[model samples]
Target: MAVLQVEKVSKWYGKHCALNEVSLEVPEKGIFGLLGPNGAGKTSLIRIINQITGPDSGRIFFRGEPLKPEHVNHIGYLPEERGLYRKMKVGEQCLYLARLKGLSSADAKARLKEWFERFEIGSWWDKKVEELSKGMAQKVQFITTVLHQPGFIILDEPFSGFDPINTNLIRKEIIRLKDEGASIMLSTHNMASVEEICSHIALINQSKVMLDGEIKEVRSRFKESIFELSFKGQMLSFTNALGTQFELLQHSSDADLRLARVKIKQGLTVNDLLQRAIPHVQIESVSEYIPSMNDIFIKVVEQPEEQMV
Candidate 1:
């Protein structure tokens, strides 16, 4: 089931197009990655989804119905920019935001107490927002965003100011939320995060969506049919064995072993490469070289505009 759909969406700032004919469907109960470099119109599209602004030409749907004003109540948005009140006490601010989301006073307090305890920040409830460090403040804001139990959540750069431990904490919480049936749209430049949590992704570049699909499918689509092999043997013998079926992309020496990155031609498999080289070398490890999301991001974004066309 799709929780959100954008059809032929386009946005413009004066005569300059910010998003052009972009369309994507986000599945229910899954994390969808909205990725791109700076000035790629990702924020424009996100703003349209949040109804902060209207699209120049397009339509959006939520839960199979036309997106309406009331849908905003069902969304919990954490924009890249933090918006906490500097002078407001932590507990007070959380209760206020919860009330704004339609929670009763008593219910808001109960939920805030639980979240504060779970996040291990209960002792800081009375502290002013300004008294907290950036990561600490981020935790408070994150708790407030999810306090109302919104059906759809949008997190923009959710891990921006955290150390590794806190980053992992947020990651675990995100997974837990998805497991509990909340759909999320995660917008970030962190490709590793996308790889770790996203079920599917839509890659937008220069106002256009260049790619969209399941993570594994997208990686396979861009695979170069390469493999990395580690072995202990004469490099010349191994290279000589691989005459035409494979091309050696790189060769390097680790302390006592030879490492070779080889690309096989189409229709050739790892078995073929192994068969040819195993006779001459003692193979320690043989693994396919699938490009990481970071590598794919650079390759796609750096492509010429005409090629993307």
Candidate 2:
């Protein structure tokens, strides 16, 4: 079941439309990537989901019920811009935030301690928020946001201030949260991270959803039947064996093996290409080239609005 459903939601600021009929569904227990470049209206859609702002048009449903203000307790949001009382002690501030989320004081303390230790930042509990570096401060904010263990999470640029190690640490925790049955909507420009954790994704451009689907399905649809073949043979014989069913796009030699990228002809399959080449060349490996999310994002965004899906 989808935990959150947005139907033709739109928002605007006076003469400028920030979002135009954006619709998407976040599933119950997996990470869904809200992908778009800067100024693509990602922030607008996220605000509507969090109830921080209302859509000028369209509706949102949370687990089949109409979205309401009180449902904020059911979600944990880590905004792109981090905010915490500068002079507040990390531990004290975390406890306050957790209690605000409806946790008992005792439960909040226990959860905060567990997370602090796990993240190895327990020593900073009594330290002032301003004393910590940007990355450390982000860690505290992250802890407080997730301490309540909400059923759904909205993380906007969650990896921004972290170094590589912390980035990986947060990535692992995101996966753990999903495994524990929390639905996550991750908004970021890091295509590598999206490919790592996102089960599904929706690409937005100019306030419209350009594409949306399971990651594998989207990649397959964008793939143009290109395959990278690794084999050892005379280059001429290999090209001649291809006949007219395939076009050799590019080829290069790495040591003794020759690697070539070939596009299959219409009405032909990888097996057909193999059948033609196996007799003339020694086939070592054959793998279909699937476009990455970054590739798809670039290609899709470059197309005219009328051509987008």
In candidate 1, what are the lDDT values of residues 1-309, reduced to their tens digit? 799999999999989999999999999999999999999998899899999999989899999998898888899999998779999998899999998888899999998888888998999989999999999999998998899999999999999999999999999999999999999999999999999999999999999999999999999888888999999999999999999889999999988799999999999899999999999999999998889999989999999877752
Q: Where in model 2 is the C-alpha error above 4 Å?
A: 240-245
lDDT of each: 0.93, 0.92
- List the pairs of residues colliding in candidate 1: none
Per-residue C-alpha lDDT of model 2 across residues 109-220, encoded as one tens digit per residue: 9998899899999899899988989989988888887999999999999999899999999999999999999999999999999998999999999998889989999999
CA shift of 256, model 2, Å:
0.8
- Per-model TM-score on C-alpha atoms: 0.95, 0.94
Clashes of 1: 0
Q: Estimate the overall C-alpha local distance difference test score of candidate 1.
A: 0.93
Could you tell me the TM-score of candidate 2? Answer: 0.94
Off by over 4 Å in 1: none
Model 1 is weakest, by summed lDDT over 10 consecutive residues, at 300-309
